[model samples]
Target: MDLSSQNRRQVLQTLGIATGAALLSNTVSAKNAVLKAGPAFKYALNMSTIRGHRLGFIKELEVAAKAGFTSVEIWIDIFQTYLKNGGTTAEAKKIINGLGLTIENAIGFAKWIADDDTTRKAALKQLQTEMDQLAQIDCHRVAAPPFGATGLPLLNLDILADRYHAILKMGEQSGVIPMVEMWGGSENLKTISQVLYVAAASGNKNALVLLDSFHIYKGGSSVESLALVNKNAIKVFHVNDYPAGISPQKISEPDRIYTGDGVTPLKQILQLIKNPDQPVVLSLEVFNESYYKQDALTVAKTGLAKMKAVTAGI
Candidate 1:
């Protein structure tokens, strides 16, 4: 029990404590660094999966938020219904913000590519209104599908490009970007090549094309074509699957199924989209009528689960 022996023991104890602290700090720092790198893609709900459930616009937001989804794509009709119920755009934005959800895009049908001048004018007017409404809620993206010409003959690609450029300019003026959506059943712009012609011919670098797995297959276009476009050209991608046994021509939007439930090569498609600058948002957009029969929360949770499963490796 000499003084020197006691001092030596105390010094050893202090050194042990110091070494442990240093190791703990280093471990935490390394773990945090890995987390900062994050995942390659973000997930979002398209709201169409629960369309049969009949939840109001606000309720839909609640369902998504409760199900752990941070992003959602809304249909324009749902927003209009909210307005009819005396809900203001500011209030809608507040509800979404309070729930910690972001509106990634809105589904809209603006026939901006119609050959008729009068029809085109009305479609442009509708676009302006929809874009303005979207801007109020701080959502700057809208889906521009060829609603009027889906069943008609395919229009000239060059003319469609001019129309796309014009609409993109209009969207720019209102701080919104109208993404040219591809419909598999549509007569025009059904293939990746056709969409590329319009998007490229638009001569606008910010031009975007909305893609869906179902539509891509329905249109008889190869899924591999997605690799040809720059990743930046696609802002939002709709994720869904269809039964392998069904012919692509026979499948409709209602036949859409949850991701990974069918035979769609989603993993391969994800590999094709190589954008290092930013993570692309994968929105689940299924119109399966059967999903509507389930409770809204269950449907949302189920959809989110399937989405996570398909993108787990990516």
Candidate 2:
């Protein structure tokens, strides 16, 4: 039917508005679907929890998947050892995908922030190679702890910031992110404040800090300060607890216990670090010798259960 110009214009405008509304509704629905499919926080098993078992790389992944963990954080040395033993990245990726698992992040002791120019250069080269390898397996993040410079005569924070910034730029090229990790036993970057400062001073938008519940206590950092941290700055958080009897100065890696099994204020810390825009990966990391004595699959299942209990209703 023929219509007046004004009627035609009005009809077109109405149709456009309807179409836009439908599109917006669909977008909202898609987002909600994604959120519902995942939990408020993604639970991941850090391979260190079972490293003492000496399970090969593939077996470790299999054990985690059997324990009902779809996300994991692997150690770089173990992964490389698999390669040294004739495992290919393609084969690793196939195995991971087949088991419905994702490598959330990797634990590497790269001395990317060393004070020595030669050491730092070598570390960066090593990291680049590791990043390239990890990317092939769909793993895009690795821990950047103060490995070489974690002893007496602490390194300058400003210098460390620049070094971190350098590796972050390298990460840009490899689609991998190096998360500044705080080590409880390390003399440097052991506190939330120090790590946060390094990340902020990096001047890179992709700067991220990897915090650990055990480290927070071991470093003697106040748990309340976590609220001051920008949620997006933390991508993966190491979830573990420690015995209250051990002082921060005396607490060791082997002292790390499963979440809710010890005295860490996990609920408060989880709430503080929870990202509203995205799911923050809660990786269960521990080094308790007792746990190591147990079967790897049993240990993994127990860790996952403990993590879920602590984060329940958070």
Candidate 3:
């Protein structure tokens, strides 16, 4: 059947439209799959909760795994010490895998926000070292607290953003993401707004923020502020409560209590940050001195139980 030139052009245009529509649908589906939430509550324990027990890296992993925690965060210092004492990442990965647990994130002081140029260089170098170790264990997140900037007046947020982007770009090469965390006592970047701005300003699509309940209350930010954050930007949320009696000014690290023992509005907080498709790690981070006196395994079990109880519904 001979067709007119106009008919041929119309058929070609129709095929192009159909092809474009199919491509759009597939793209949307892949993006949605990445954001689709996992289990309503994914529990993770930060090693700090049992730091006083002085458990080794492998021992701590054992404690978390035996306690039924699917995920755990490690401290950079401990992992470094393990290496200093002749430990290997391959060995660590074997132990972690054998126990059926995943390393969710890590805690490190990068000092990347220092006002001094030389200091900033040192911080990034240290951060890359830590990130390299984390990547070996398949961990892709690290906490970026205001380590050196703490108690100092706010530095220029724009400068901070640029510095953050620098490390984030390095992370791209190292396969890890640095989470700009809030420190309630910090003189800089202590609030959700400040952290979010730095992250957004970095212009990296992988920018993320780490939230801690204690820091939120300590920094004098209301729990409601969490709702303003983009949920995808939160990969790890530190779960701990602070005492009502202690004023924010006087609060210290040792004051952190278990998840439900204190007065933080955790349920409402979770409801705001909880993503249904992507798994948000609820990491237990506490420094209560009393917990250090108990057996490390006991502490791990208790912390995991409390975390589960508070995160019960979603």
Candidate 4:
């Protein structure tokens, strides 16, 4: 081959190598960018944060979506009111999907754990109806707090487990999972220990617990206890903070402040509840009257920002 032909061949080979290297570098950089774009946790807004504004069902959902939240926790009573006022489940599903929001769970006051047989039966019927409605809206979880049994004469744990198992059975039919919830002020199932005990005794693999930071403090359960829980069992966590001075016994629902604004050891608690398989839904649930008095959009935006700030770098 002539000297010029040899030189041309060498030049083309060098250019090819350079182009290949550039392409590989670009691919790696693109992958890293995609990873960074996805957050490690999911954020949600519990309608209770803006419930005081009385935005109603659809409006509250609209405000949440406008604030950049794609997930929400709704109250069953407000939802039923909307239905009574001529809103259908099909319409509710359309509006929610149109807003690009998912109802992660619903808060209901069904007396599923009551000691009275007739009352319990009626409560189960109510839950079945609510579950059917929630299923239609594509919401698969509901809070099963000890509403009626929170008063005197603490119920037996074994019986509570049986009751919870029954509720779970009903949920199976509707494709909805009932999450056993704890109320700090309640007489029964007021602590993480009690909740875990009931869940374990229920002997159902699908039994899950819904926890709240405020309720943990109210019930006098240590945030560190979260480390003992199976992270997968906590599908959705209610995030909030409490001031340093107020005693748990004195603290009320109205005292809940935005995440990271109070004295809750949120960082550690979040780390404890971190699941290796999937991101946990952190739902902001505060009922501060001050927040309720503000513009609903502003409140929703602030709550989302606070949640993001607290979960940043986790």
Q: Note the residue pairs that clash in candidate 3.
A: 36-277, 36-278, 37-276, 37-277, 37-278
Model 2: runs farther than 4 Å from truth?
1-38
Positional deviation of residue 166's Cα in model 1 after best superposition, in angstroms: 0.9
Give TM per candidate.
0.88, 0.88, 0.87, 0.88
After superposition, candidate 4 runs with Cα above 4 Å error: 1-38
Question: How many backbone clashes are present in model 4?
Answer: 0
What ranges in model 1 sit over 4 Å off? 1-36
Q: Count the backbone clashes (under 3 Å) in each candidate.
A: 0, 0, 5, 0
Range of the 10 consecutive residues with the lowest summed lDDT in candidate 2: 32-41
RMSD of each: 7.4, 6.3, 7.5, 6.2
- lDDT tens digits by residue: candidate 4, 1-314: 99999999999999999999999999999998767665557899999999999989999999999999999999999999999999999999999999999999999999999888999999999999999999999999999999998884778899999999999999999999999998989999999999988988999999999999899999999888888788878999999998899998899999999998999999988989988677899999999999988999999999999898998878
Q: Which of candidates 3 and 4 is the stronger one according to lDDT?
A: 4
| Clash-forming residue pairs, model 1 | none
Q: Per-residue lDDT for 235-255 in model 3, tens only?
A: 889999877889988999999
**Per-residue error (Å), model 4, residue 78:** 0.8
- Compose the digit string of candidate 2's lDDT tens values, residues 121-225: 999999999999999999999999999978947778998899999999999999999999988778999899899999999999999999999888888899999
